[model samples]
Target: MEILIMLAILSTVLGGWGGLNQTQMRKVLAYSSIAHMGWTVIIALINPNLMILSLMIYIMTTLTLFMTLNLSSTTKIKSISNLWNKSTPMTMIIFLTLLSLGGLPPLTGFMPKWLILQELIINNNPTMAIVMALSALLSLFFYMRIIYVSSLTMFPTNNNLKHHWFFTQTKTTNMI
Candidate 1:
């Protein structure tokens, strides 16, 4: 139990501090995942069932993010800065997804974090809950940065590149 607590704290801190200087969008997301995993681990110490739920939610959100990035061909922070110029709808999706991943209210992402925090407090571990909350703020900072770059930046007017028409594929195929 003592070791788990220490690992939880270490991971939370490392996840936040590690992403501070990352220019690659993937790296930022990876660190954010680490931080979120730390939260899951913290709760796992008290209840494994809750941890499973949290991990599943995290996986779903990450899958959505990676798929969006893959479709947009965005790998770095700078590449994503002009996403609004490429596709407004994709940009909006990415923005909302990142915000949800950041644990904003009324999103699926918030549900697990809320449950974990509640569990922590109920389990008589207010100190851990406080620390986790603070670390979460650090993660939110990066998420907001990504959101700003992807949605708030202006498109370059001097570019001569032809805009590609985006079409949604209605055909669903089995991957298996």
Candidate 2:
């Protein structure tokens, strides 16, 4: 069980790191969702009774986050550097989703983690609880970086920009 958990966590970390570093926005979110799901699975494995509940909640939250990201036409941090300046509504949604994804309290996203933590404590596994807490913190860092890239700065307008993704989005929207 521990080996499986380690493998799941490793895959999520590598996948998110690779996708985000490559500036592929969708891939980053996709991989991030994978990582989050992994944590949920770890919690569930220890408490089989709560598996369905946690997975269901995670799925719903993942769907909402993906929809928000899709609507913004942003696949990478570089594509939406000036997101707040370009579209305030999208920026707000993105920010809210990131906060939720990070499992901030008072949001729907907090429920699964809260349940997991409670289950862990009930199971009397302090070591696993600590690992889960650290994993949540690590995931938060990446989500915050993505948020920073989108809202906290202007998109660089220059030829040296490595990604040409926004042009396709612009062209499609113009056709509409």
Candidate 3:
């Protein structure tokens, strides 16, 4: 249990640091994985019996969604900004992933939280459960911020003045 806790702590710190430091979109998602896995590890310490199942479900869903995102033309926020005009499917998936990460209902994310909360309640660890649940609200803020940026705004006129090389490549390749 102690080992798991320590590893979780280490993973979260490393992942958070990496996510914040890098500009590459893939690395950011990689870091997000580290941080999220950290949470699963920590939670597992409190609820050992259910940890494996929770982790399995979380990892599967996250990786699957990320794979879809990776195959997508849009990777970074800057690229995502230009996406409103490109493909609606890409835009919608990003929005859905954001919502899933925020643990909205009917998504895979809701399952883990539901299980975690149930475990917490069963363990009679109401305080920890409440704290964890409330802390989720903070995560929601960041997710909502991303969603708002991706889905709500029109592209800046000034951005049009800059020609993205990648866009040219994509166009050229598609033509061939």
Candidate 4:
């Protein structure tokens, strides 16, 4: 149990810090998964029943985020910059989904973390709870960067290509 807890903490810290310098969206997601997995593992160590709950939430949040990235065929951070220009709604989805992925308040993603933190405190493990919360904050920094890129960036008129990614999005396709 001790070893597993350490691994979980290590994963959370590494994932939080590793993504700070990443350029590829996939890599960032991968790190996010690592951190999330750590959270799951930590819950398993302390409260085995909650592990399933955490995993389920992680899967849901990750799936939505990946779907949005897929919508834009997003690869590099630069690729995300033009997503808003093409589809405003998709861009909005990406923004909200990313926030949820970061475990901000009032999102599906925050539910599990909140439960886990509460569990930890109930178990008399405030230190672990603090670390987990801090790691979430660290991860949020990178998510905000992605959100900023997607929301504010646009294709420069002087692009080497004559036409930018053809604006296939005639109308903001209503999200299902």
* lDDT by candidate, in order shown: 0.82, 0.69, 0.65, 0.84
Tens-digit lDDT string for candidate 3 (1-176): 66775686667566655554454557656766776676687677787667777777767767766776676655675566667565656667777776676577887777777788788688786765665565554454555666675555647555455543335558779889
Global lDDT for candidate 3? Answer: 0.65
Tell me how candidate 4 scores on lDDT.
0.84
* Shift in Å, residue 83, candidate 4: 1.3
Ranking of models by TM-score: 1, 4, 2, 3
**Candidate 1 similarity to native, TM-score:** 0.85
- Name the TM-score of candidate 4: 0.84
Which run of 10 residues does model 4 get worst, by summed lDDT?
159-168
lDDT digits (tens) for residues 33-116 of candidate 1: 789879888888898999999998899998998999999998887777677777767877787888788888887888888898
| Winner on lDDT (3 vs 4) | 4
- Give the distance in Å from residue 140's predicted Cα in candidate 2 to where it truly belongs: 0.4
TM-score of each: 0.85, 0.72, 0.67, 0.84
Q: Which candidate has the highest lDDT of all?
A: 4
Regions of model 1 farther than 4 Å from truth: 156-176
lDDT of 1 at 47: 89
lDDT of 2 by residue, 1-176 (tens): 87877875665465445544546767667767776767666766787767777777777767876787787787767766666555657677777777777777887777877888777789887666676766676666677777776655775455655443334558779889
* Candidate achieving higher lDDT, 2 or 3: 2
